[model samples]
Structure formats: structure tokens, C-alpha cells
Target chain A: MTPHLSITDQPVDVASALAAVQTDAAGAVNAFIGTVRNQSGGRPVRRLHYESYDSMALTQLGHVVAQAYEKWPMLQEVAVVHRKGTLELGDVAVVVAVATPHRAESFAACQFIIDTLKQVVTIWKREEYEDGTEWVAAHP
Target chain B: MSLKVALFGITRDIVGTSVIELPAPAPATVGELLAEMRKQYPALGELRSCAVAVNNEYATHDHPLRTTDEIALIPPVAGG
Candidate 1:
């Protein structure tokens, strides 16, 4: 089976991520893509620099996937990919995909994975504007 | 014992190093280590929040620390 969680500096490939969770038994698939927006909190974003405590981030991601599986037993598989390092506006920052036997479960599990990952994963991003930069927390 | 703690994100920038070694009290728990870190690096206290990880798992402040444990300071996460 492919890894259920990953943290990398390379661009997140949505297709490959979807393929990882796809299975013959799966009747539904859902995905969530997080992109670097042009603006945040009314500030114009020039770019974003992401960083991670890679080992810990991967461990936390596994916990998130495990929780999703426990909550939705019908889920066939889940894949979470997060990009680290600098990214320009509009670049994909992260992707979470889930495969299940039904659409509702797939969507719910996908959302749960991303939400929990954001809360527990050890990743951080520095948002840079034209004037300055600041490290943003997952929660306000 | 001297314990080396890995730093990330803003913590790395504030301490100006990726790793820092602290002379921990004997039989130190994560709480004790955090106190020492705060005393040494006041900037860490200014963050909205932070978490401690021992051996790649999220650790409670009461989690015991050994000389061999891999500890890291995890500032607030922002990943999607």
C-alpha cells in the first residue's frame, strides 16, 4: 500500500495522490486542495515559506489517518500530502484524498483528515508580504 | 543531564539555531524542560502556543524525558 501520509518540499501532485487512494472496491473519492492565496487577513501575500518538523509531522499525520479510518470503517484508503519550503501565490500547499464505498463517507473522512492534520501536524508557514513577513499559526 | 532539543519554524529563528542544548534537571519532565527553555529564551513564551514532542510523538508537559529521548519544540502548526 502506498504511504498514507507524506511531507515534502516538492509540488503536490493531485493525480498521484488520488491514485494512491483509489481501489477497485472504492465507489467514491473526495479530495481537498489548499492553495497559497494571494491575500490573507487583507494583506497582499507575495509568497509563503513552509517548514516542518518532518518526522513529527509524519507521525501526527498518521494519527490523523488512523482517526479517520476508525471513525469511518468503510474508508478504503486515505492520502495526505503537504508541501514544504517556499511557494508562490496560487501554488498548491496541501492535498487530502479519501476513497470510500460511498460519497458521504468519502467526503466526511476527507474533511476530518484535513482538519485534524491542520490541528496536530508539526508544520508552519511564514507569509511574506511586500513589507514584511510573519509566521502564521494553524489556529488564530 | 544535557539534553539537546530540536527547534523548528519561529523557534529556530528566535534562537538563531536549529538545535539547542540545555542542562536539564535530573529526572526532567517536559514541563521542567519547557521552564528552562522559557528562562533561557523568553521569546518562546511570546508565541500563541507550542507543543512538545518526545520521540516523534506529541508529549504532555508531564511526559518524562530521558537523556536519549529525541525532543523537539513544535510551535503552532499552519499546514492544511
Candidate 2:
């Protein structure tokens, strides 16, 4: 099955993401969903603004998926979606799901996708507070 | 030959533009290009970390750049 990897400006479709990784041969599926929170660095966050380098972001996401396939050869299907633009508190920021013959590999692949994506994907987030705004993790 | 560098996130905020053009006779390599960028835009040096990508792939400092290559500044990523 073709992996569902995308960066979109629209709201993330969790159901579609899960469906993308569904296969008859799969015994277990694992998913990781990331959402915006209300606070950061002890300050109240009004919202979050996400931006992407577009082409390069997609390329990096593809690389992450490719690495996942190499690490988990038993993986049946995978789906990863990240949202861009302003996001309200409690809104989903990203979703990653994986399907495999066993539960262990499903969980491992899903976790690996999200973790590696956070480190490599060319996407950024800026936290907006009632007082001001600052980019998340833009500095050490 | 001039080179156009794409910027995003905080780098765009600091540079005040989405794209910056280097003067004629661009730097020979990625390392030289980074040094030239820091000199031209001092605020870029303050970032905790910054990476370079050439043609959509992460590039090392020694990666030689061609005139037709696509270049971008990648600030510390926070995506989940």
C-alpha cells in the first residue's frame, strides 16, 4: 500500500489517517496524535502558528517514512499528516499511524515515525500568547 | 553568479524576507555560503542552531553548491 505522507494547510483528518493504514493482513495498528496545548514556558498560549518549507518539508517527511520501512520490514502500511497555519488549543497538529502483523512492531513504528519527524521535518511552530509570540524550540 | 536563498520560520522573521539574494560570484561551498550569510545578516548568528539544505536534502558544510541548486535555511525544527 502507498504510504499517506502529506503536509496540508487544512485541519488534519484523523479518521482518514487511520483508514490510510488499514489493511486486511494487519493485526494491530498504532497511532500517535499531537495537539496544541494551552501553556508553554509557564505562559498562557492563545494559539499556535505553523509554517513549512513546503517542498523540502515533504521531502524530509518522505525520508522519515523510508527510514521507518527500513527499520520495520514487517510494516504493512503507514500514514503521517502534519497541519500548517494557525491552530487553536486542543486542535490536532499531527498524526502518525502504522500497521503491522504484530502489536509490538506497530507501536514501535508509530513511535519512531513521530519522534524522527519532530527532529527532521522542515516545519516550525510559533506560540502566540496574550502578551506576545515566540517560535517554539527555535532556540536551544 | 548570484544565488537565491529561501528562508522560513524564525529565519524569515530575522531576515525580514522570504528570499535573499547573494551578490555576484556566490560562495564556492556550503561552508563559505554560511559564513557569508552570517556576515551579511548578523542576527542569523544568534540562533541556537541552523541547518542548510541543498535541493531538498540536508547538506554538510563541505557540500559544493551549483548555480542551479535550490538552497534554504532551516532553523531549529519543532514539528511533531
Candidate 3:
């Protein structure tokens, strides 16, 4: 099954990611959603601004999903959706869903996809506090 | 030769531009390109980690660069 990967400036649709990975033959489906929180590093964050290198981010997402497929060959479907733009607190930032023949495979693949995507994807986020804004993890 | 380097995140903020054109006779490799960029824009040198991507793929310092290659400065990523 082909993996569904996307980068958008709008709110991430969690249902669409889940639906994309729905397959009758799969017995287990797992999903991981990342959201913007109210605080960071002891500072109260008002919002977040995400940006991406568009094409490169998608390409890296593809590579991450491919690695998961290679590790879990039984994976029947996969979907990764990441949002880039100004997002308020509690907004969905990213979603990773995977369907496999067993629960173990689904869970493992889902975790791997999100973790790898964080490290490799060409995307960045800036934290907006009451006083100032700083790019998250940009320096170290 | 002219080379264009795309910037994103902090690099964009530091350079104050989305894309920048390298001077004529561009650097020959990723390492040289980064060095040249840091010299031109000293603020870029302060980043704890910076990566170079060539044609949408992470490239090593020794990787040769061409004028037509899609070069980008990738700062530390924080994507979820």
C-alpha cells in the first residue's frame, strides 16, 4: 500500500489521516497526534508558527514511511499529515496513522514514523510567547 | 557561476531573505558554501547545528555542488 504524505498550512484533519489508513485486511490501526501546548520552557506560549521547505519536507516524509514499511512489511496502509502555519494552543500539528495485520506492528510502525519524521523532515516551529517569539530548537 | 541558496527558519530570519544568490564563482562543495555564507552573514555562524540539503536530500560537507543544484540551509528542525 502506498503511504499518504502531506504538508499543509491549514489545520490537520485527524479523521482524514485515520481514514486514509483504513483497510479491511488490517486487524489493527494505530495513530499518533501532536498538538501545540500552552507552555514551553516555563514560558506561557500563546501560539506557534510552523514553516516547511515544502517539497523537501514531503520527500523526507516519504523516506521515513518507506523505512517503516521495510521494517514492518505487513503494514497495509500509512498516512502522515503535518501542518505548517500559525496555530493556536491545542491545535493539531501532525498526525501519523498506520494499519497492519497485528497490533504490535501497527504500534511500532506508528511510533517510528513520527519519531523519524521529527528528526528528518524539513520543518520548523516558532514559539510565540507574551514577550517574544523564538524558533523552537533552532539553536540546539 | 551563480548559485542560489534557499533559506528557512532561523537562517531566513538571520539573512532577512528567503533566498540569496552566492557571488560569482560559487563555492565548490557544501562545506565551502557554508563557510562562504557564514562569512557573508556572520549571524549564521552562531547556530548550534546547521545542515545543507542538495536537491531535497541531506548532503555531506564534501558533497560537490553545482550552480543548478537546489541548495538550502537547514537549521535544527523541530517538527513533530
TM-score of every candidate's chain A: 0.95, 0.97, 0.98
For B9-54, candidate 1 gives per-residue lDDT tens digits of: 9988888999888764543889988888888889889888878899
**How do the predictions measure up, each by TM-score?**
0.95, 0.98, 0.98
Tens digits of per-residue lDDT, candidate 2, A8-113, equal 9899999999999999999998999999999987899999999998899889989889999999999999999999999999999999999999999998999999
What tens digits encode model 3's per-residue C-alpha lDDT throughout B1-80? Answer: 98999999999999999999987888999999999999988988889789999999999999999988999999999999
Per-model DockQ: 0.67, 0.88, 0.88
Q: Candidate 1 versus the native: TM-score?
A: 0.95
lDDT of 2 at B36: 91
What is the C-alpha lDDT profile of model 3 across A62-119, one tens digit per residue?
A: 9998899899889999999999999999999999999999999998999999999989
lDDT agreement with native, every candidate = 0.87, 0.91, 0.93
Of 1 and 2, which scores higher on TM-score? 2
True contacts kept of each: 0.74, 0.88, 0.88
Clash number for each model = 0, 1, 0
By DockQ, the better pick of 1 and 2 is 2
User: Who is ahead in lDDT, 2 or 3?
Assistant: 3
Interface Cα RMSD of candidate 2: 0.8
lDDT of 1 by residue, A46-115 (tens): 9999998888889888888887778988889888899999999899999999999989998899889888
Order of models, best lDDT first: 3, 2, 1
